[model samples]
Target chain A: MPSTYSRTDLYAEVQQFYARQMQLLDGGAFEAYAETFTEDGEFRHTPGREPARTRAGISAELHEFHKRFDDDPVQRRHWFGMMNLEPQDDDTIRATVYALVVTTRPGGKPAIAPSCVVYDVLVWEDGELFNRSRRVEHDQLFGSAAAAS
Target chain B: MPSTYSRTDLYAEVQQFYARQMQLLDGGAFEAYAETFTEDGEFRHTPGREPARTRAGISAELHEFHKRFDDDPVQRRHWFGMMNLEPQDDDTIRATVYALVVTTRPGGKPAIAPSCVVYDVLVWEDGELFNRSRRVEHDQLFGSAAAAS
Candidate 1:
């Protein structure tokens, strides 16, 4: 590992990196976001579900997903809060947070969806940050059923 | 870091932790599940809302939330997907996920309430996990119109 940052610095780094990723997603920078991981990194979804186990696999999946969905005119803004961080030996970290994602369809008002709980396991290698594992714990779902009915 | 696990092992750990947390929530072990964080951990709600900045605060908030609404007899299962993780130096990590939470009302069957997105920042210390930050990005309120009406 390079130099270790203080808690405040570490938290700031984490927050900025996170914010940048979200910005990339909202700005349609899908490929840039995919490149953030290490060559052998993995991206897992739900705990029990199948995961993209390799960097290549994750990249390909992201590419495919963007190809299929990025063109939508709907606006998506990912909002996150309650960040928790801990130092694992000086190089790895385990963190969790709650998130609420808002997607506004064109010409429609925004809505408050249910909350989601997320867990992340991360490692720093070769001076760049890469995700070793990520688990998303979902919570309440807010608005869909009644609208459909 | 003690020893770097293979990508597969990391993914496995992520899955295991995710499953454990979910199982606890499903089994109504809310307090136990909340204990997953460090003493000074945080639980944040998104869309520019306030977050519980301490473990005790978050725990108390959840306890009250589940308790107050527990008698409502709503059985909820959170379905999570579209997860991504980022390494933020050593001892800290960041992640985001897409989620769909389904709430099954008593004898009403299961339905998708609303879809949401979450972002998490976590830390690992002493071989344990902790949350540093969380943000919720709510998409839409499903039953709000009817409730308002």
Candidate 2:
């Protein structure tokens, strides 16, 4: 918390940071989405499972993951909800969010995104908010779910 | 926070509460598991999709949901992780846990359980930790995921 920190304000700002990241990712602005995090920010989807740890890495991962989406038959969307914020230290707050990833195929209903929890850390830097770290806890056996795909 | 509440102690206690609940649920001890909640505990899988409220309701729902499992060939396990606690007020703390419900067949590898977030409101009542309410945020489409089964 900063000298001028407002609890409500900070929470709201942190919530919007998620919105910004979502928009950029959805709009195909992978680099912009990755910039939402700090230079040393981390995004881990499962404990001890972080594919990317920096903006460049995030961008590269996103590219490799989604660049093929256009060729695939299903469309995907990431929905994050149930956001709760807790102050962790002087400069950072942990934001725990529920993520719903939906995939839709032609002439079919939207499939619920897999179950996962995104534990994100947002920090204040020079009066701006940036995601410092994010760990996504995926509920999947090692190769159980992936083997299906 | 209580007058004598140690952050470390309370956190550990809360962590154990989750462990106990998991143990009971995994062991088919539905009634005992439901006892972990207060009289008016609420179990909502989605924000607006609460099918059961109150301890008795929770017990009833669990029985109805699980009674059929014993006759099936598959087995289930609930894995909870990334538990983050936040103080709600004087008497309650929110335990946000990432849950992965895995199922395995007799001769198959363990499958990824559906992905969901368990938002539990843990209350300190007369020195007992009771789950006041739990909202399970399941990221699945209405019937797309279930239709597969």
Candidate 3:
């Protein structure tokens, strides 16, 4: 079927997708968050490290990664903006967005972690958008570590 | 003329408008930033203070506000997300978005100022979107001084 979704529609859908996805991650719903991606989706959070492939792998990696903050009262909120969406001819959409992770603690000021640029490849499955792949580049580590990859 | 833009189109346009508007403000182009609003635009940055009315007033206020950072190496970036756009029957759009100001100083960590929720009434004039009025609610000051306003 020819794609009926306009550019504007795609933009809105993609933004909504990220909002929900980040919420699930920050809320510690690892399994549900993993479901937002394809079965064999790949996520590369670190440049020099290998990507966490497959839904199970993604969930497990995130689960371990977030364990350190479990004992802390800090709340992490992911905010995404300046998104650019490009639809490809192969029924896939490329989305690039700037991400800021805000950490706030009770009775203290909020802090911003290192900024990142995320590149996501999304596909439509059963009338829903799913991330097929995601690569995150940390702005502060662009030269030293990211260049090593 | 009846509105031809779809809900999705309006969302995309509003997001892009903010992206450009914030860039101009962070870049210290106060005159250009004020021009993005209507001639009689009202901006209330503080809850207990009177809003700055008119484009000229807005420009002057921002210019004086940013002067303190002239000698500092800190760069402030305004990031907005989680926008809710409602189109009114009278050809106006109401936008509510979460705003975060990230301040980065040279050779130091990035910090987040108090987060805010921005409410804006927008209208179309000369085929472009312009803010008619803006009211900012600081998240950290929800019950303290905001209650007095």
Candidate 4:
């Protein structure tokens, strides 16, 4: 059956989920980050880069990736703005989140990279908020002396 | 008399404005870009070292900055996403847009800068969509390269 939520109700649920996601990023809980998605979820960073194409693919790749990230002492922060959440028919959502992700060298001037990401997300099978599909669309890159022309 | 719009309506209006803004940026029409805002309207780039306090500041700065860039003959594209729009009284709006700005060189790769911008916008006093306010806000900046780290 299709899931139905008033636009207001839907926004409310997504807001909570979004908040939690931010918290995890701020905390640098990479393993926890991988857990936010479902077993068969999809996380796509760059438009053409497919780190995970299916449920199993997402799980394996992120689990390993997060494990490696967690081994480092890196602190990460992802600032989100410009979110558009359009509900899909199957209790899922098609949304986009613009993020400014910053990483510093323990204590150093931050490097700046601008990114545009699109997400195709699904709620949990148990009727909770979880991601089924997420496509991270990278629209641009900026402020890298090495990456500079 | 005051102007009003439902949240959904307001979101749509902003979306249209964004699409148009992107169009102008893609075309390299900085003058047209200046026109999107009111005569005294503001345009700001986030992750800037200093904050812009008013529309006049943004307009004059952008006009001059673009003139310099025009002489350099650069190609750049801005991708906007993750927009959160809230309605304010009297047709004013508080909107945040996340932008991934990319600058490209003839034979070089693109540079990406991830920026988080908050806009405190006023609507057209004439009661149409074209109305603009005097100030735009850019709250924070993050480097996208951090995402890889």
Candidate 5:
């Protein structure tokens, strides 16, 4: 950890990283989105559901997720807010944020989807922040009627 | 903002603060939980919902919330994970974490309740950390069928 990173520059950078990740995911850019994670990144959608533990696995899970909902008119949007980063002993940083996932159908107003808590362990490699692991504490919105994505 | 705070002590302190907050809230220690916040702390359960800005108001809100579910067999539990802290220019810090609120009914098994993002602004006052504000970005679980407690 650098001594000079105790200010707001690091905060701004972490915020931008989350904003970019949301944009890419919402824009249906899977490959580009996967690049944001480390080559050996991991993503746990829910506690019991399958976890994507590799870059390729994460990419495939997201691809299949979007594809499953392709025909549905509900447009999913992830809005992340209030990101805070804690520096680790090495170059790794852990970021935690509130995620508001909204869904809008063609004829209806936007409704709050299954929002979640985004826990990300990010690593600094090659002068860039890459996600080492992401765990989503999903809001099972409608209980049994809805499942984790 | 001290030169020595750049090390791991601050990080550990912030994490312990969060852990203590959770323990207080879950232990039914309302006074202690309310004391964790500043005198003028604020809590936003929803974007438009009324926020509790005063210490008394915060205590009342939480009291009412738990009271409503007192008779129910479901025991509400808040499991917080991956707390990250961002230091402000002043001495205030922003902490974000992934929160999983679960409930287990007497006859039913444990089920996940609505999980959301918990964004907390913490300030150090009088040699102790206090919560300045807490913003919960709910996924609007079950739409308007359920409200924040």
Candidate 6:
């Protein structure tokens, strides 16, 4: 189906969606963050790694992955910019954004994690946008490939 | 005057404006970057300090500030997120955004500078958006005040 939304509306919608999604994740609301994705949404943290498929699986994986931070809690803020949005005929929008994760320990200076480029497939369902899939490619891991691109 | 654009258009316009503006700055196109602001634009890198007033001043200040990188160049990426835009009655828009500056030296890991919240007053002139004033508040400097907000 053709999208009823104008280009401006689509872009704003996606921007707001990611803003809220990242807030949920950074706030440690894994379940709420996972709900921002489709029921069978797939998230690939790295290129070849097995994806954490499905909303439940995603939440569980996040919970386990973040356990290491339990001893020393650091507030993580995901900042995204230079987003390019492309709308497809199937009503899915492809969004590629540069992401920088900043971690701030209490009373300590902020630190930057590896920079990443994230590619996401977003769909509108019932007047709300949801992530169908996301693949993150880290710059350090793919140095030359990332730099060339 | 009321805005001619819808909320969605205004949001997307600001997003694209910043995306291009930041690219210009990071790419070291100081003159082009300064062009994104008004002729009499005011940029306060921090609160209470004398602002880099006017487009020419902004360009000059940026050029001088970036000279340190000449000896040991580092790629600086400014990632912005969680942007909030409000259209004012005076035909201007107030935008607040969270910005994280990531710097990467050659063959070195990416480093995060202090996290900052930027407040910008933007106006439309000649069918284009331009920044009239910008004030940045860094989390480390403000500490409790930033965390509270």
Per-prediction DockQ comes to 0.05, 0.03, 0.18, 0.11, 0.09, 0.24
**Model 6's TM-score against the true structure:** 0.61
lDDT of each: 0.61, 0.71, 0.82, 0.57, 0.71, 0.83
Segments in model 3 whose C-alpha atoms lie over 4 Å from true places? A142-149, B1-3, B17-77, B81-107, B112-149
Model 4 Cα lDDT, one tens digit per residue, A1-149: 12464554565566678778768756755456556778766687655465675555654665665575665665656655445566666656766555555665566756534334456575756667777777664444322322456
Stretch of 10 with least lDDT, candidate 5 chain B? B103-112
| TM-score for each candidate, following the candidate numbering | 0.50, 0.53, 0.61, 0.53, 0.58, 0.61
> Number of clashes in model 3?
0
**What DockQ class does candidate 3 belong to?**
incorrect
The clash count for each model shown is: 40, 7, 0, 24, 0, 0
CAPRI-wise, candidate 6 is acceptable
- TM-score of chain A considered alone, across all candidate predictions: 0.78, 0.82, 0.92, 0.70, 0.86, 0.92
RMSD values, in order shown: 12.8, 10.1, 6.0, 9.4, 9.3, 6.4
lDDT of 1 by residue, B1-149 (tens): 12564334443344445545654564577677667666777776545557776767876776765775545656565555555766566747676877665565433434556677767776777765556766666677535635766
Report the lDDT tens digits of candidate 3 across residue range A1-149.
12687766777788788999999988989999999999999998766678998999999999888888878989899878877676788989887677888889999888778666688999999889999999996655543442366
> TM-score per model for chain B alone?
0.79, 0.85, 0.93, 0.65, 0.83, 0.91
For model 2, the superposed segments whose C-alpha errors exceed 4 Å read A1-149, B45-50, B142-149
**Order the candidates by DockQ, highest first — what do you get?**
6, 3, 4, 5, 1, 2
DockQ of 4: 0.11
Worst 10 residues of 6 chain A by lDDT: A1-10
When 5 and 6 are scored with TM-score, the better candidate is 6
Give the higher-TM-score candidate: 2 or 3.
3
Please provide the root mean square deviation of candidate 5 (C-alpha atoms, Å): 9.3
Comparing 3 and 6 on DockQ, the stronger one: 6
lDDT of 1 at B64: 66
How far residue B23's Cα lies from its native spot in candidate 6, in Å, is 12
Real contacts recovered, all predictions: 0.00, 0.00, 0.22, 0.03, 0.00, 0.34
